[model samples]
Target: MLDFTSIVMTIAPELWLALAGLVGVLLGAVFGDRFNSFSFKFGALSLFGAAALAAIHLSGGESFGGLVRTNTFVNFAKVISFVLAGVALFMSESFLKRHETIRYEYALLTIFASLGMGIILSAADLMTLYMGIETLSLSSYVMAAFHRDSARSSEAGLKYFVLGALASGMLLYGASLVYGFSGTTSFAGIAASDMSNGTLFGMVLMIVGMAFKISAAPMHVWTPDVYEGAPTSVVAFFASAPKMASTVMFANVLFVVFGAAYDQWQLIIAIIAGLSMIIGALGALVQTNIKRLLGYSSIANVGYGLVAVAAGQEAGAAALLTFITIYAVTSLGLFAGVLAMRRRGGMVESISELGGLARTKPVLAVMLSVLIFSIAGLPPFGGFFGKYEVLRAGLDAGLMPLAILVVIASVISLGYYLRLIKIMWFDEPTERFENTDAPVMGTVVLSAVVAGIVFMVFISELGTGGWATYAASGLLR
Candidate 1:
């Protein structure tokens, strides 16, 4: 039995963020719009503090009757999520100010969402999982529509809400079935229970719902619109932190609750992986809007991560974490470049809008190109190394067919990724985009540098232990 003090110590980061969110709510109520800038700073600080606390308390154990878990695996996800979320909030202050009314509620909502994602990373029970996911979903729905003045933003939010609710219902029904068939809501209990047909059906439903959350294809209808309609800064956050948290959760539930049924579930995960890659790779080819293209690109990337997942075992889990971390940083860098594309006319969303960007804004163009190359899985970059690990995992697991699909998808993805680069470098110069301010420039450069160099350092420094590989090993052990 765990004492209250021990539980508190274990969940220090979550407690801190929870308190911070409530305080932000109070401040917003008291000062209203005046609190916007301050809220951004405060939210960023609070997230940073949560990251620190998570780092300090990092270790593995179950508490609250095994309803929550604490470990290097979960902590790794939480810390990265908090830090990336902090970066998003820190950068968004200026972007929000420039485009629309910077509401104090936005900051609080982000804080709340971070709090939810923190729960997601640590969730150990079915009820806990549902709560965390819904919290994150609700906040995301609101944030999608945050630019209330725009019909597209409102539409994005509404579509997200309706679809999100449907997904939630499926998840709930699955959870209920799992509980009814397995006789408990605890993941450990469910795993220990017999694999009845009803239980398997429940697991499938749950996996289907989770696929939607991660924007896997066939269930990824909401992604493109949300990416296109939401504010760029918010899209950046959506692409990075939430995806990281959800993917980690996906791996966690699989490894912990469903490991007993690996033989059965592996095929399901593999099928989803193939669909995501095919749809994402093909869908992006026709897209004219850069954000919509990225939306499909993200779906394809999720497929790549799922390939690692289908491979199973410690190596695959390690590859998944490493893949997602590199992917998140790469995405943040890419979107940072996008955020900088605001011109005198307005924000640039179309692919043609970037014509001759290299000639006009060489530094920004170079950074965006580097990120695109990195994501395209080209050589000597983080994305390549990340995919290398994933392919290695798939081959090690004898998933040759999936590996072949991965290669084919990589070839297909080059169509759009290279097209973006070509337009930036070779096309005729268009109207000059807005001069990128210091914060945005720093974000672009920092993300690009991380994509270009940081993962190399991580890979070189990694051997037998450290980071994604080690983190995954810790959980598996």
Candidate 2:
């Protein structure tokens, strides 16, 4: 049992960030757009602060009378998501300034979104979970339409809001049913209750809602439109932080709260996994827009993560975290590469525009190819190992067909990934890309380096895999 002071201290990072966001709102109101640069840096540092605190205060316990929980698993999620959120803010500062849409509120909203993710990772009860989900959804909807002048931006905002609202409703309905059936809103209590028909139905609904939030297939209709329509910087952020949080949430709700009913939910997850992979694989093939292609790629990657989730047990959780870490870095790099595609002070989005990239920007072309190969699950990169772990986990859990499907999907995805590589290396170069922003370049280089290095430690006997296994044990126990 934790004392009040100790409980508050455990959650200090979130408190610190919330206070920072409040201060940022006041800063923006007083200084207006002139404060944009400082605000971005301010927000980024604040996110890093939260991440550092989480890493430093890494321990296990429940707080707020079991509303919020913190442990190695939750802290690991918090640390990674907060770091990604900070990078997003840093990247946003330059991109927003260039487009003359820079606002202090942008950074503040991001800070708030990061806070929501923290709440989610720490959530020990259904009510806290719902609050965290809504907080993230509301902030993200606004950020998607930050450029209110553009029709595409407005459309993106509207689509996300409408779909997101529906998803939220489903989740709440499920939560209410769960409370009614279990006689409590606490995850621990719900997990301890008998698995009745009403509870199972409610769990399925909650899973559907969560799938929509994560853009897993059948529920993933809005992803491409939102990706293509939103600002590249915003999409870059979306691809990393929110995706990580949602995946972790999916695993948490499944393995921690509903572990006893694994036999019941496992099939549902496996079916969704197959559908997501098929849709993601085929969907990207015809996408002419780079961002849209990436949207589909994200859907496919989620499928890969879910394969691990369906595996169950400690290995499943470890593989899921490992895959997500590599995926997040790969995505940041790919989107940062997108951020580099500009000519004559205007952004470019078409896949064909990448023609002759090797001759024009050799370094970027290579970096992108490396990222593409990584995502395609090619050899020696971190992504390949990430895929390997999940597949192995699936097979070990007697999910032979899902493992086979995983291999087939990887093969199918190579079609588009290789197409991009050929275009960059073989085709005649398109117009020269304008000088890339420093932050954008930094993200690309940093992500690529991490992707390159992660594979080494990821496979080592005492490295990333071990850390993930330990974290998984905490959640499982």
lDDT string, candidate 2, 1-477, tens digits = 549877876787789899999999888889887788899899999999999989887776668988988787777778888999899889888888888998888999999999989888888899999999998999999999999999999999999999999999999999999899999999999999998999999999999999998899889999999999999999998999989988988899998888889999999999999999989999999999999999999999999999999999665888888888889888988999999878874887888888988888888888888888888988888888889889988988999989998998999999999988888889886687888888888888888777866664455531245767766767854
In the range 267-319, model 1's lDDT, one tens digit per residue, is: 99999999999999999999999999999999999999999888885658888
Q: Tell me how many residue pairs clash in candidate 1.
A: 0
TM-scores of all candidate predictions against the true structure: 0.98, 0.98
Worst 10 residues of 2 by lDDT: 456-465
Give candidate 2 misplaced runs (Cα > 4 Å).
Answer: 461-465
Considering summed lDDT, which 10 consecutive residues are worst modelled in model 1?
Answer: 457-466
Model 2 RMSD, rounded to 1 decimal:
1.4
Q: Model-by-model lDDT, in order?
A: 0.89, 0.88
Candidate 2, position 92, lDDT:
80
